[model samples]
Target: MIGLLATVPALIAGIRALRDRVLEVAASGATVVAGVGLLAVVLLVIVPSFEILPKSARDAERYEQQQRLDELDDIDAGFGPGSAEEAGQEMQEYVDDALQLLEVAPRTMRTTTWSKSGTTAAGNTCRAFHERIRLGDQVDRSSSAERLRTAWKAESDHTSFFERNGVLELSVHPAAATISWIRADNQLIVESDCIPYAAP
Candidate 1:
């Protein structure tokens, strides 16, 4: 009977060890399953809902919209009624006033022909006059050139005589309340072209 009691205790110890090992295995399996589930949540649900998703496509659409708006603004800026014609009329008046000065250039400084061309914008005008002064029944070139210079001095507020590359240059700017010019052999005068005509 003593031997029987000893065997019964060993059998109880073996059953308890087997039960502890089964419990440990079950806990480890549960931990692994929990970790895998958490990883799945992060990858499949959380990542797809992130705000940064689709950011590139949104930025591209915004860029395209801005480009379209800029093009429309450019097209609308040039569209208007009579804007072109009004500019033309104002420019012509400015040109006509400037031409009057050429008509009145010293009567002795002969001009073979007048070729005037110019453009006006923003209430300003630019003119280019091509003039030719030919000797008129005068044998002495110096005396003839001097006579013309004297006449201009009498009528102008500024007079200057100089030579460049052995070519004589006499420039005069008469006191015109409207336009101003520098004249010599040929002339390039720059001043406001739209000012009201004032007799020099």
Candidate 2:
């Protein structure tokens, strides 16, 4: 989506040049071919950059998850296993910081102030949510973590996280302006309306 949006100006320029007949037919054809090729290359380059964005999100999520794991380890180290109270306390702390760790709403998030619809929805609320995970760890269906894990796994066109039973449910499209359920929360929380584009 970002790739396509970024390419709009170049696409427009190419079209304008062709319309103006700035070059002979043969030259224009070559330019068209080159433009198409450049588009392909740009898409390829942009695809990898998208990976960087999500991977960074994943990394932060992992780190936060690990921090919780470490806290659990420390609690268990002192109190032995089955320390639900301490674990829950640690989990609460984990929940508090999970969203930040995921960096779901990075300070650099791009927002379009101009409304395409010419009117913005009133009383809209947006917030970012994240669920944490460890490296090589597949989502465990039995745990609440599955809520976010499944969403991330099922990422595709028109999918977004909605909340149900204090957990996130992935669906074709979510109503909220922006919704992100990272592995840390395992629940749906409102995300930034500032995001006009589709989720990564």
Taken over the whole model, the C-alpha lDDT of each candidate is 0.39, 0.43
Evaluated against the true structure, the overall lDDT of model 1 is 0.39
Q: What is the TM-score of each candidate against the true structure?
A: 0.25, 0.29
Model 1 pairs in collision: none
Those runs of model 1 whose alpha carbons end farther than 4 Å from true positions after fitting are 1-111, 120-125, 136-138, 142-157, 175-200
Please give the distance, in angstroms, between residue 124's alpha carbon in candidate 1 and its true position after superposition. Answer: 3.7
lDDT by residue for model 1 (66-86), tens = 665554443245422122233
TM-score, predicted candidate 2 vs. hidden true structure: 0.29
- Which 10-residue span in candidate 1 carries the lowest summed lDDT? 190-199
Candidate 2, residues 1-200, lDDT tens digits: the string is 55565555566666677778776575566557657866786777766887899999999888866655554454345532132232223333333343343433434332222222111122122122222332122333245354355544566665554554544544333222333343443333332222111112
Off by over 4 Å in 2: 1-10, 25-30, 49-52, 79-200
Give the lowest summed-lDDT range of ten residues in model 2.
Answer: 117-126
Clashes of 2: 9
User: Which candidate achieves the best lDDT against the true structure?
Assistant: 2
* Displacement of the residue 68 alpha carbon in candidate 2, Å: 1.2
**Backbone clash pairs in model 1 (N, Cα, C under 3 Å; residues 3+ apart or in different chains), count:** 0
